[model samples]
Target: MTTLYGYYRSSAVYRVRIALNLKGLAYDQAPVNLVKGEQRSEANLARNPQGLVPVLESDEGTPLSQSMAICEYLDERYPEPPLLPADAEGRARVRALAQLVACEIHPLNNLRVLKYLVRELEVDEDAKLAWYRHWIIEGFDALETLLKRELGTGDFCHGDTPTLADICLVPQVFNAERFECNLSAFPTLRRIVDNCNALEPFQKAAPSEQPDAG
Candidate 1:
């Protein structure tokens, strides 16, 4: 069986969970408690040299790391419900949208970065939170502008069906909400996230539903 090594609330792991669920692929969860520094354990380092959660070992025992790469691998391997678009132009657009969140927003606010701000830089809690909200607001502002201006957006990020963009968007939105980042500015993002959360695959993949949530 496929196994996913993940932390319950890690947005990157949550993204993979959503992708796997959407693909209708059954997988076992191997919880890595990031808060307890389990991600740096020898086992996890062997699975992912970067010491990250969400190392997906395929049924054939092929271990894959990095959420975007894993998601694209799944899309190619299981081409039924295509996560990307058929056309080259559409595919590029979808990938751009997904990257806007995954690259532009998520990196600065992930657990490791936050920890670095606190432990390494000696930033107080309030400053760390300010740093978090600052980046979220900046990224969401750009995302909202893009989503609103783009003609490709439908119920989801690409078309009526959920695509790779939606898969990435939902998890980032979850993190934004968790940080209490003011989301009143991004109605388009909110609507897209609502559409995504309504789906069974996305709901099942939520952090709260994970075995290690508590």
Candidate 2:
């Protein structure tokens, strides 16, 4: 069986879980407790030198790193309900949307960055939270405009069905809400997230549903 090495709350890991569930793939979870610094253990380091949660060991025993890459791998390997669009243009748009969050928004607010602020820089809790919310608002502002104005957007980020964009969006939104970031301005984003959470795939992949959620 395939196994996922990840933390329950890591957005990157969350994204992978959603993709796996969407693809109807059954996998085992090998929790890497980020809070306890288990990701840095020699075992995990052997899996991924970057020491990040979510190193997916494929059924063939091939280890995969990076959430986007893992999701694309699953999409390619199991093409039933495609995660990307059929057309090249549509695929480009979906990738752009996915990267807007995965590359831009998430990197700034990632747990490691936040830890650096508090542990290394001695940033207070309030300031750390301020830093988190700032990037979230900035990114969400741009994302909302694109989603609302783009004719490509339907019930999900790119179309009526979920895509890579939706996979990235939902996890980032979950992080934003966890930090109490004001999301009233991003109605379009919220609507898409609500639509996503209504599905069983998204529900099963939620952070709370993970075995190590406690």
Ten-residue segment with the worst summed lDDT in candidate 2? 53-62
Judging by lDDT against the true structure, name the best candidate.
2
Model 2 stretches with alpha carbons more than 4 Å out:
none
Model 2 residue-pair collision total: 0
Model 2 Cα shift for residue 45 (angstroms): 0.1
RMSD of 2: 0.7
lDDT over C-alpha atoms for residue 158 of model 1: 88
Backbone clash pairs in model 1 (N, Cα, C under 3 Å; residues 3+ apart or in different chains), count: 0
- Expressed as tens digits, the lDDT of each residue in 134-213 for candidate 2 is 99899999999999999999999998999999999999999999989999999999999999999999999999999999
Error of 1 at 189 (Å): 0.5
Q: What CA root-mean-square deviation does each model show from the true structure?
A: 0.9, 0.7
Candidate 1 residues 42-161, lDDT tens each? Answer: 999999989987899865797899899999999989987999989999999999999998998889988889888998999999999899989889988988998899999999988899
What is the lDDT of every predicted structure here?
0.92, 0.95
Instruction: Write down the TM-score for model 2.
Output: 0.98
